[model samples]
Target: MMTHPPRPLALGTALMLASQPLWAQETQELAPVLVQERRTVLPSPAAPLHTRTALPVSVAAEQSFTRADIEALRPRDIFDLMETSLGMNITRQGSRINNFSANRGGNVSFLIDGVYLTATQAQRVVGDIPVGAVESIQFIRDGSVLSILPVMGFGSRVSSPTQGVVVINTQPAPGKAAQDRAQIKASYATYDSWSTSGSFRHSWMDGRLQLGGGYQHAASQGKPDWNMAYASDTYMLHGGWKDPDFMAMASVFINKGEREIQRYIGVLPNSSVAVGQLNSATWKYDPRDTQVFTLNLARYWNGQHTTALTYGRGKADGTAWYYATNVNPDTVAGRYFKDESTDLNLSHSIVGEQNSFKVGAQRIGYVQLTETLASAKPAPREEEIYGLYFTDEYRLTPAWAIDASARMDKKHISKGGDKYGADGSTLKLSDDTWTDKAWLLSLGTAWQINPTWRLSGRYAYSRTPTPDSITTSANQELPDERLSRWELGLDAKLHPALQASFTPFYYVIKDAKVVDSSAPKIKVFNADTGSYEALSVYTSAAEVIRKGFELSLKGRFADDMLGYEVGWSHFKDDSVTADSGTVETPKNRYTARLDWRYGPWSSTLSALRVDEYCHYFQGACLPTGDFTTVNLNISRRFEHGIKVSLYGQNLTDKRYYTRHKTGNGQTVYNLSDGALADVGATYGIEIGMDF
Candidate 1:
């Protein structure tokens, strides 16, 4: 089972081996062309999107969700696999749902072709990326941000943002060594809504350089005050080149993404929070253009050491703000805003005896400028952040290896506005240069205890950045948002075709930030005074801890092509109430997904459950109980890049909220248990083609 690191068969095997317990199967190396960037530049002349088992970690995991062998049928996103893997659950309070991957989405980081694609969306912005366009996705669940993997902040924990790299090959180019393919997909849902997308790609010599483009649009219908209209478009241009001497990939997206949020909460007019909903509120993140360019240069020097230099530049310009407010039913409260950022990145990796180490640096300039009418005043600031990180991986033994790394970021508010405590107020504060620094450490061990069995585990200590408001001395440096995480687990091979893993983990968010901001200059005051200790663009200086267990199962009992997988997880956040002094966790969440394939038929089944989730507004919760849901998908495959899929979600019409109740009484947490759930079911018929 020795892998050459340059074979398609080994690629899939590597993915399977890295994710779960390895099976007893012969392995082979991939074609020379396949292992090189040149392969990606060539087309298979069979499909639109590159359909292969070999892909980098950044691509989404397709077989995990689309395979039908051991699966029933379900409709879900690629991230949904984590739901079942770790008994994870997603709660949608309003229109947006936070999609977590393996590890209950805890400590998950996202990347597209090595560029970090991390942004806190005002609301759930539907990305028009076609699932079929994905080639393969690599994941390092419960790993470290330094593990060349993704890790998200623990839930409700205040931590600075971090990112890993992701690489995607939407289409293969022409005249190259790799296969080129295009993918077109169309689907219509229950609300007379339909989504259409098309993607094209081409390549150059030996797949040294690849070019790809894609576009997607989806639209639907709704009621009067509850009108629902969502039509969005995204255009992407991506290219990559890999040679013995250099490797580079660049991508840009111009998106006019829009969404019409229905006033489903208007019925609860008693809660003025609903006031914002009835206003035909439309949120459009319309990014005129977002671009990311990455270049990697590596050469084998004397075959003993590898020298590499990586550089990246990214820019994002778009509108980022909320329009209507429940506090003010009038249109005067709504206004447009702007958000823009520019960043540069560089890294170097070196090889050593039985060990490899890498170090990198990043500089980012961010600006939040409001785009208001002539009458509007400016409340904008420009800030800069400098970050440095290093990682090391060791090959202790063929059976057991170890990985460790750390990173630090120093952020400076080169410029910002002065703060006034208010008229005769002692709380007056001035803006000072703010700096944030972080560190991360991780250890991993993978032991092939025997030929038929293997075991692995990981534990990490990581510190991310928090908001400047969290640390101040009349104006002090921002505190470092910190997280202490430890994960212990085991993988076992019951047989060759069957595998299983159980991982229980714990994480603590120290000095997590609590957001409470205000602008007293204008007579407008936040009535929630006690909670309104202070106002800031971002805030959190509290401590919160989260613990959970994750389980994964997948085996091939049928033919070799048939794939089966099932996963489940349980998560809870323990806390004590301020008044009653009772210990409780947000909720007990669970998820289950099964996928199997037989012949051309592939089906999947998924389920999600959250126990007694408390929704507090102003300081209240909706109710106590288990909120559950189910989804299913069925599809068939054919030759020449053409396939159709039938999918149904929320089969039981279980209504649930994507968000938790955070406010208090007068304007907060009083409501029916599942008032925010999407109770109705949605089904869609999809047609896909690649080549």
Candidate 2:
């Protein structure tokens, strides 16, 4: 172990540090009265670098999820965990995966290691990724248009990706631990579900080189008779080398997951149609397999100059049940998509200066292959995207800072497939490629106001092309989406142990993709009859406007051992059509979490409440009921590096549906007889050992 002497701190730094939440500052505080007392503490087994709780204030309004938060919540999956977090809503349909939206009906995007995950098929598999390998999750509510534009312009449907960005950072290399350390955990829960996972980190050459790996397996008997059953296997490996002038890191991850789905069931038992009841019929399989590899290298020079290169490849293959008028509804089909990208970034800052600048360029390519059946001819599609961006940050004074950025992107899409005529003649689909281009600009400023208060505001504008989806055909083209947003925020330190924030925002998305269930049945030719039959399909509205405000408060007491967080969001999202109908956003939503720790025992109590909203059914708005759920968890740690935990989800045993979106992009009810069908109370216990 090595220790370094503490250096004198500046007055501004001291004031800023004092404004941070007590819970996040506890482990970093040190008092040095004399020269000998200046010795810093070395690495300890209880505190690992990869699990640090440091949260640097950002220009954008942000929320964070740390390892400590995860340990207390014991969520069943990422979606389960995020739903409990601030500013996120996930509703479960009849399948294992759920519908997700953030910031009160704003689009949400996901990224891993700064690499775009949503542009690839990997986005569909995010629900199955093992959280065992995750180090931290950050949700930037007001993303910079420069960063959001290229992603949206390329393929993402979010006209305003700036509204929400979820960045997932996996565990990094081992720290300066003297020897190898490891932990293993096993758990069982209601619904006949179980999981086992293990991870280990080791360092070599005085911590200059490090390696780590983790694996997890989980399975669950979702419902009766194996319906909606689920299972998954995931593995991750990471390696890194660091030195004074250069650093390199590499990581690889693979996931194989399977899920079962139950088709639409009517909300009423004796309604015009019967649906959603547990039946003896076998559930359809929705299998997903994903693999990703990423490498990052950086070079450092004197006087605060650095250059970095990053490259990542991600691929996903899966089978899903799609409604086909000509085939059995229970059948599954295969599809695959792949993404590759490389980026180069350069940044410079003068030593002891208050300004910084950064520039970056990137190129990405994606491929998709789809087939209705194993022997059917495949449809191949490809896209190429190129981007360039620049950002500048300047501190006008000790209490004021401002930033500006700009970005531009170009995307090209092409497809290859056979067009079959009714006379059995084959025609070549147009190989001519189409291209889209977009640019974005943003500006933001933050003022400390005083030692106990801060204020910030931002405005951004961007344009994005229509999103490409599995159902999109070669000839299906739509106009680009345009968006802009302005937000104002206030942060206040009400007390030494309490912190609060209030953010008000407004955004408009033109040509946005809003839920629309009014589309009539479409005709599809059947080979058997050489005739056409009409089948219902989902649809979407072209535009909308969203306005909202978010409030959050957190407090810590009892020497940072007891803490609580409260969050609330109110929004009004409406379509621009003549009807002026409200969009699928909750008018009011609230969340609360309380955490307490005494000696070796810790506990967490959480709750979520959502107000009633409108749902589209049969081309009409229906009242979707409001619901509330409470969850609890308790855990104890022993002296022998062993820990045990017990948790219950929906502890009140309340009956509720997570809410669902149908194939036609319309929100639908998932209840039966005015009660939940499958999502009931669930409980679990876990035991683990650290070495």
Candidate 3:
């Protein structure tokens, strides 16, 4: 191993000291096939990158999440992990189904390398909980935007390709100390359902090459609300090779992921009838099928400069419905939609005076092949997008810095439409193509603020299109989507080991494509549209958030008799200039946790509360609901790496849904009966030995 002396940092050089290794390609003999595997420790614990924590904010927990972060969290499910992260929020209409929608703040966008994973298909967004398959996640704020990534328009959606980027790395380096790792989990909930999975990994070649995979089978949900009760099986495959000049990671993900909820779900208005509600006999969702492939490459220019490239492909197979008799039933019903795409990107980094600049470009194209139940012809629709981007970061001082980026994109939507006469006399679909060329620009600055604080604010403008799954029409909307965002934050060192941070942000979104009418499937073009504001605060020293505030007390309180932490935040949002007044935003939320340890065992109790959030849109207002839940958890760590844990959610078994968005586009009360979850209690045990 070679190590360089600590060098003086330079301006335009904040991005240097990148991962650069000499290609040990084919330098060693082949070894027996091995199991596959999956942060920068901040010099100062308090100075986390961009304060992005969301609400129910705990004033006592200040730790951020990363690939290494999730391992300790032992998240009960994917939803729990995401909700605890900063700058990211996934809204849910009910616990039974996560159909509401998702959004991330500022320039925060999720990615598998440089590819856009969220826009691949319909109802395929909830794929969190990577199962220890995550690599290092690099959170890049609008430092650049690449076409291969998801469209970045205005709205609460995550945009600005990496003003800061969070790249979750699932591959682990090879090493010999005769090292090994294994993870196994089994869980049982109500409805006689259960799930179990296990994964193992071994490292070699100093962690240069790693391979790993996992399989899961869960007792299906036959809950009264569910249409069918069937077991689900999922398998994960991943592999990777790493060296100086060449590095690659590829995966083949096959999961039998499907769910059938009663068509008439959630709290609904009395006016709506169960015309086509999904029931035991009729409700169906073509099991979601997805295949993911990705590759990453690096070419070193010198000891001080390195360039890298990434590529990915994904395909989704499923059947969607026409809720309001919208999607021409014959075209969308019982149809097979194959969303497949290829993404490519190349990035270059160079160490400059006191800083470093990294720039890259990406392009993505998707082919949507559909076969309607009514149409014998399996027509094909192609969507193409390309982007060019660049970013520079200058380090002014060891504790202060600045970064900025710019990008441009061209999008083409090719759909086969019936012939349309140029004059308004005939009503026909035109085969004419629609292409949108847009330029996205953004800039950001990070300040150490002080010895105990760091602050960053960013502004970005982009012209991307809306997602097709949610849009009412195939006709592309060429309008530019513009956005403006501002964030100001403060972090402080209350004591030698105690830290706290507070950030308040403002957002303006416009040119969004939303369903104007459910009947007949009509879309209306609206401009300069919605606006939202958010505030987040984090205070934790513990390695995990769900562990509550115990981590902070030990860090600051130093294992005192009583140690605790509290987090609270406020998020209020609504239409900036629409007839609809303030919509209920779950943003107004708060959380507090207190944990104590009496020798070998520990107990944690947490309280979570959410202010009224927009549940249904009706009348001249958006109806909302409120939620408050309490949870209790207990765990024990024994000698020789053995552990046992137990937890209970909604201890009071509060009869409340997370959020509501009913009324079938009209105003109505909805219970989301299918989602009415019973106050749940869970128990689990783990046994491990480190030899």
Candidate 4:
């Protein structure tokens, strides 16, 4: 499919208004309207003392993005935003779809509005939430900065802290009567895609109560192809009440969407890779629906001490089908999955002139059910987690500070029911219940050497529970995966307008889980039914080590009219279990952006680069090619409360393959079939207003 530019009429109108702002000015009486500014505005969450963790400089680094940055970039989705961020690796699988790894590599935790999203819901955070609903995006690369219970609650048991954490704060209700505000935004783009979003917050009862809601709808028939069509809708509602001694808040979010299932196509012998040749012509799609609700209550007994309680419930339903060729019969397999979870958390915090302390307890219950029609097996699993944590931060001198934290967690998982195969044959299940416990600790310090330079260091130990699907040693018992990390950094202010930082870190994981295709599969046969059932399994491997360094520079010139940020990273990961030399992710990545504003016109240009790597967990270890792309956004602010933008991605229209491999890596190899592909140059336009 050919790429298209933004709609001519929209582009021309926006440019005309920006160039001739005097002609568009109006002298009309205005009510109490919210004024929009062009600087990063940090979002302050409700009950910050308990909900959001205070980022300690010695423990981890923080990256924050605000509304001004979001509007300037005009991101199509979360994927777009992350793709342009520094030290992040984003691989595009399709339009508005991507897989990402931050810093070292593993699964990152996603928290919205200070409430941890369930596993099923967390997977969609990058693609489902509208930019209008976000007040700020904060990324913390160090797990030691927060309590282990929260980190583990949002992350899978099989993943570790090396994966990093992302906190997304949604727009809160207005806190003042006159500052109440509302907005509406609409955009149209290539491939017959469009979106509409709006949100508002109003305060009443003498600024003691607030209510707000937001809605977003986005749809696309990507590239006018039968295989590339999808649509989604998102809704958010929130309410808050505040008094001198007590504060309470509640929020609800709903997301429903469907998309054509995209599967990998193998490579062809001695041929070029292209989108048209990379997909199976299967007529199938996947549908999903998810909803989540959260409530928080906090009370202040004195100026220095406060207590808080929080509760959350979430549910998700999903179903999909695809044709599998690896099996003997090339069977069409359909699967259904369900997830439900509830969480309760209690915490207390005390603040003093030179010291602070926080203590919290948490409990989480989760259930997952999976049914596959092709295999005809229904497997259900339930998990419960209980944890206690405490943190202390203190300043020892004018130039030195220290902090420490400790946490303990107990986890239990139960497998339910014997699973049946397609022929009504049942396989006897293994042990029904598994229990594990672990403790984590972190210590760090920061020193200010001079007015322009500072140094920090931290050491932490954490653990990840092994899933039941993994095979144990000769004893046939599950093992808990453990991780230890050490990091050191230097932050410097070279000039009043420029800043720089360099961080180097290393971590290791014990009992790393490795997928072994050559290992024996589990098979069970019943004499009564004269049928057999088989299951796949994984084995434990030696220690896995990951080392990395991140460097960044930021500068604002010409009195803040011009701004730029550059980030570069290098990583080396090795798994002794895989027997392979290197991990499946890239070793080098870079991202940079330049922003310029003059009068009512503003623009941002960004670039990203990712090195080649193998596909992780695919058994075949397919090697992919390197990729680089550039994006640009330009917008004009009109005097009458309207702003218009024109944006384009991959302006050069480079073609790249998503998954690449010869059939076999250890033996004779040939181009495989059905490889996945990504899109080319795309463009769009947006218009928004606030009143």
Candidate 5:
């Protein structure tokens, strides 16, 4: 058994210092002090770097969360944090693996400081980062053109047509003074889980140059019979320099972890297995490691023009172990894989009197190799992508604006591997290559209806390449997926202390890809077992229509001491096929949060409700019951920068299970018994300090 070290008292002291100006102003005694502070805190006069294009007007729905929000929510993991956003859903398939969907079966694109990441890398890196290390998170629900820049790479595109994007920024804003500070946090929770982290930041030259680093470790011995023990360690280092004309930032992140696949406690209704018997393949990732690096640079040629460049690299290696049924130790197999990716982007922006224009180019490359117990050698797959794009925003008047964007992307893929057949026979595949190109477009407009109201609308068309599973399994190329969407939004200041927004959206997708488990089984050779196995077949649907609406209200009252946020999202999908169905996404979801503060004490309460939805599995639609959960956090802040908090999740101890998408693109439960229940009520206390 592994145990955490002893806890320490939360005690720290912070000192504040102010600098005097070299020259004093005689007009007023405070003028010089104010001027000096502004100069040090404000950004340079040059145009700042634009990682992603920003819309001139609020034509799309977007949600943003600050560090304060994160602290109040007290989320335990990335999945918990993302679930707070509207129209977003997270389902965990393994301890560190998850599926993210937005707006009714639409895939999501993920970015970190404008650096694009593949789907696999996103899951591995983002899930490992400590919540305290994140400075902010933004969710773009309707800006397809602006969000599509990251997916134009050779790396795995969104598995399905994307309806949203999630951007994470880890760098924190510089403070008012050049200072050095550190933070330490630790907590213990149910199931013998423990988490600990430490971080520090140092600034120099009037806060113009800074360096920061952190390390985090977490482990848990899950409930008995679940076999879900997990452990991970993460390290991060970042540095940046800023000046009037030039800026540069670089960061490196590394994570290593291992998790055992969970098991079920009961048998399915139609299964022949014994009653009350635990069932599932015994599987685990013995060891997995991933590393990521990014560099960002910007040159402000003038106040009106700027050039920026961003580069990123990622590497991952892992080994998986599979044991015979009943966890027999004498018989086992291993599968090993390695993946690497590189991405580069360059852009120039021009600011005119009434218009702004941006042009950019990007290149991305990826390589993967895999070896199994029975394979003779490692198989290799490689890809390269090139993209060019342009965007323009014109202001017709101070009260109205219009924006347009266009992009062209091309990708080339080469693959050589051992193809297995029905009777456990292997066929060596030659180097096969394929190339594809696509174009995307978007148009948007906004109008100020009145002093307190605004209206906006946007239309966008996007396309993505078919998934690798379908292409590789079929041993051929396939038609790309395409989608078109329209969204309308209205924002209103209903009261002096309240704001509200309403959005309605519609989407149409062509050649939607899916896996049919009930269809004729495709026989595939299992390298580890040296035997043939039946697997799900992949197919494409002609079309799918999805429509949804979102409503949200946020405000502060009681002299800013009490704040609240409430949101509701509803969506339904219809597939144009008699035997096919889309049921992974719930039709109705509701979320609410309330914050209260009085002097040094504060509390936050949040709730989520998801309506029951059918899951398409094995040609049948099974009902997945609805569930509701509540989380609460209470904290006290001391004058010396010390904070202590108590947090609890699923306070009611409700039991529920979520549907997840499998590697084969099929929707199914996490357990072989058709049920993977959530970990019931858990409580923990955490303490932290800054100096």
Candidate 6:
């Protein structure tokens, strides 16, 4: 494996090109197109309010990317978009594990058109969604109590406000007039990869009713000898109806895929201590499928009060193959896993002259089942969660306002089913039942000092339940994790065309969950070895603190033909116990993006820089150097609604690793991998047409 340090030359070159004045040439203005921009305002069970009214300054600190933005960036996937544009750091445990973490080893929740997905479900579906189907993506960092309502219907490890929430909307916009719209696109890139997608929408009855559907197919042959080939197909269907007093919508999404896991590269030999190694050459996931459905209904009364109801369900099934060694193909084994969940929510809201309030209640049922090739029966785990929440916004004065929210949740979990070893012998099974309760509270205030400047502050506290997967006989009764946070922000209009924001925050977590590798809690049968193996136990840490600040500046120039944005973020961690230190994450990050449009041509350039950090493994911290990468997209529109574009990623060809870890002594090997390093500089061409 090879690694490179940050390249100042690449950063400087990208900035220089962005500053060019080529867009200053005279050009004809194009027809105005209506773009829907909807922001989540209150804790409603239905979809977010479609009104254009802006949120109060105190709780308006959300970041959003529209469909137009996506078209200009041309990210390969959602994960790529988050890392390059949203300033989010992603960590993957391994290719087959499907364990993903963001920020500083924190869990982030996902919501697709008001349907919540659990962490496990998110891992399998987030990356599979067709990029062409996304309408908007929003990042709500304030941990607004309303944002957590979706997750409440589906319990998750995203307990703290610092983890944040990512809301993705895939529903197509309802045009103003009765019409039909359709588009199709195709793209081919490096590594013998290609993709094709098509979508259509039909609206009738004075634009009161709408129907749409989309399909996508993609395949890729990864780097030679890496055994990472992948392929997938996705389908979507949606319908909506709106009237003076009522609105209803429903959608269905399906995805299926298969891929071979990448092989792990060995660790650096400079270390003195010996570490475990794992052999994963024959590891892979074959025949995986996922399906999700959502329905929403809302009613308005007297234009001052509203009631809404939402229902959602999701299901996933997959098979994982593990071989004892690369040479022994005959020693292969398979494990099948299935996940299913359903939720229902009801909410009501009232508007007043000086005060606004919303209340909601929800229930969720989830189940997980797993079985080995030799097992007599599948092992099953089930969870039921119930929650209630309320939010209030009050105007103390024209220049001052206050907001508060509270939520309560209860969860019940049970585990059972038969277990068997490779030798066909019965194994010990734990049939346990447990109940947990948690709550969250938040308060915020905003003051408009003047027309150009606004100040806001907020505080939040919450308790998160432990995940069922990590629970064992030894720690099945562990206490819940507790977290608190404080944040302050200031927004300023520096100029007529420029705006800036600064935010500083402090966060603390107590009784954090951690795996105790040295303490084996239970013995699990290893099919390959035909014997029992001890598994690690879960424990709690005393405390950990994270302090960070974010700064951003964005605006348009050249009469709005050119747009630019710059952002910087920094974070520092303090752990009460060295063994419980935070995961490897950059202490500082810098990002910049420039979008230029001239006549029928449009282009976008973006860059990201990450500071060096250390990875903690086996009680040793190893340094991983910093790096920088740049990406560019340029497109041209032709007559008859035809369009063509060129996309380039990691133009600098900077090589860097996303994660560093030692494997199990016998089978798994040390590994380090990332996007640029996995496939090198990638270039692609895309063509599309609209009718």
User: All candidates' lDDT scores?
Assistant: 0.48, 0.63, 0.45, 0.66, 0.70, 0.67
Question: Which candidate model has the greater lDDT, 1 or 6?
Answer: 6
Tell me the tens digit of each residue's lDDT in model 2 across 190-228.
Answer: 988989999998888877787888999999887564355
TM-score of 5: 0.85
After the best TM-score superposition of candidate 2, give how far the Cα of residue 652 lies from its true spot, in angstroms. Answer: 2.2
Name the candidate that leads on lDDT.
Answer: 5
Error of 6 at 378 (Å): 0.9
- Once fitted onto the true fold, the runs of candidate 6 whose alpha carbons sit more than 4 angstroms away are 1-57, 96-99, 102-105, 147-162, 173-180, 270-280, 323-333, 374-376, 416-434, 465-478, 514-538, 576-578, 666-677
Of candidates 6 and 2, the better by TM-score: 6
Give the CA lDDT, 0 to 100, for residue 153 in model 4.
44
Query: What TM-score against the true fold does each predicted structure earn?
Result: 0.72, 0.80, 0.70, 0.82, 0.85, 0.83
lDDT of 1 by residue, 1-691 (tens): 2333554556665675566533432353333234522121111112111111122111111123222222244333343433443332333444332443232334344444444433432112213333444433344444353433222221122334332222333323223425676778788877777778887777778677778877877567743344445565667777777666555556665556555544334324455346334433333333333444545445544444455444444444444323343434344333344444454555555555566566666665655554443355665555666666566656666555566666555556755533423331223223447644556676655555654455555656766654432322333344556667666656666875777777677777776544333312112133212222222223344777777776777776666645556555566654323221122333455555556677888777777675665443333444533656678888888998788888887787855444433333333333321233353678889888877
- Runs in model 5 with CA error above 4 Å? 1-49, 53-56, 147-160, 173-180, 265-268, 272-277, 328-331, 374-376, 416-432, 464-480, 514-519, 523-525, 529-540, 576-578, 581-583, 660-672
Model 4 spans with C-alpha error above 4 angstroms: 1-48, 90-100, 148-157, 160-162, 173-178, 263-276, 281-286, 323-335, 371-378, 416-434, 472-475, 516-537, 576-583, 616-621, 657-671
Tens-digit per-residue lDDT, 492-546, candidate 4: 7777568988889898878766544555434555432233433334455668788
Tell me the deviation in Å of residue 364 in model 4: 1.7
Can you write out model 5's per-residue Cα lDDT over 115-213, one digit (the tens) per residue? 776665566667767788787888877646573364444333435445677878777643422467898998888899898999888888877798988
lDDT of 4 at 447: 76
Among these predictions, the greatest TM-score belongs to 5
